[model samples]
Target: MIGLCLGLAGLVWAQVPTPAFTLAWDHTIEKIRWEEDYRVTPQGLLLGEARVRGSGAGMEIPEGAELKDGSWRYHRTLPPLQPLRVGRTPEAGDYQLCFDEQCHVLSEWLGPPTAEQPALELWSCAQVE
Candidate 1:
């Protein structure tokens, strides 16, 4: 099994079990729901699928995406991302990180964002060395 690393202000803050996980958030501009699924790989983090409920500004439905059951679903062939950054700001609200059949608020894991900490970094623990 591999572990997922969470970093704050360039330092490792916490780690979580991450064979696969889903991140859900509401679009800041459209106020619509969006979700993405990712899996940990030796190369990095691989995005498997993305889904969004409705579309609006900055939320263009990707080409080849299918509208099914009121949501647009699609997949991308992007390379494994070494580290994914999640920003924290009043305007952007919070993110829901889920795995192991449970969901947690970003703040619950990283605590409230402060002036000094503007974002959280996510990467596979294999890179810790």
Candidate 2:
């Protein structure tokens, strides 16, 4: 099984079971929802798809994106990423990790934030122990 590790400052804070998952959040400026789907692979994490509720400053729809169900959807052909960093602030609310038809706030999984650890990091790891 593949393990998705959520960490702070190079320390693993929590491990979530995953073959695939979606990371979603609202744009800090526009408040529009953005979602990215990823799959855990042996090499790393592979991005499967992305969608956005609407476009705004710094939220441009991709050239080949399709508008469907009030959102712009697109697929990317980028290489697998080893570690993904997500910055968080006390005021910006929480990031959602969705899978198995349910969503959970990141902060809820890892507990409260700290003054030093301002960002959450995600990476593929060995089976959760």
Candidate 3:
């Protein structure tokens, strides 16, 4: 029984993939900051925290949301993906980060980070204070 339990746990852990890279954005001019930690698994992509910044509005998205067609709701249901790309996600030219309550539009394309860039894991939550 213990061995079977261990096997099941291992199987579940193996399926929960970790992200290859971190993501972040700061539109300080508009006082907007977005940070997300994500990973793609066989089931779909998983997002954590999804902390918000800049919008005095206190918008919060519950964790454990899956990335489906660029959108995730309070429930874990996912949207649809296009070909090899996950829908509604940032790419190079077309991307949309829509949370349960708020959405932050992103470019589909991304460029290399600059020296002035802050650490991905620890970007400031709020530009003001």
Rank the models by lDDT, top first: 2, 1, 3
Tens-digit lDDT track of model 3 for 31-56: 45555554433333444445444343
State the lDDT of candidate 2 residue by residue for 15-80, as single tens digits: 888889999998988999999999988788899989999989998899999999988999999888
What residue runs in model 3 are displaced by over 4 Å at the alpha carbon? 1-20, 56-129
Scored by lDDT, model 2 comes in at 0.86
lDDT of 1: 0.83
| lDDT, each prediction | 0.83, 0.86, 0.31
Clash count for each candidate, listed in order shown: 0, 0, 10
TM-scores, all models, native as reference: 0.89, 0.92, 0.30
Q: Residue 89 CA error for candidate 3 (Å)?
A: 14
**lDDT value, residue 3 of candidate 1:** 71
How much RMSD separates candidate 3 from the native structure? Answer: 15.7
2 against 3, candidate with superior TM-score: 2
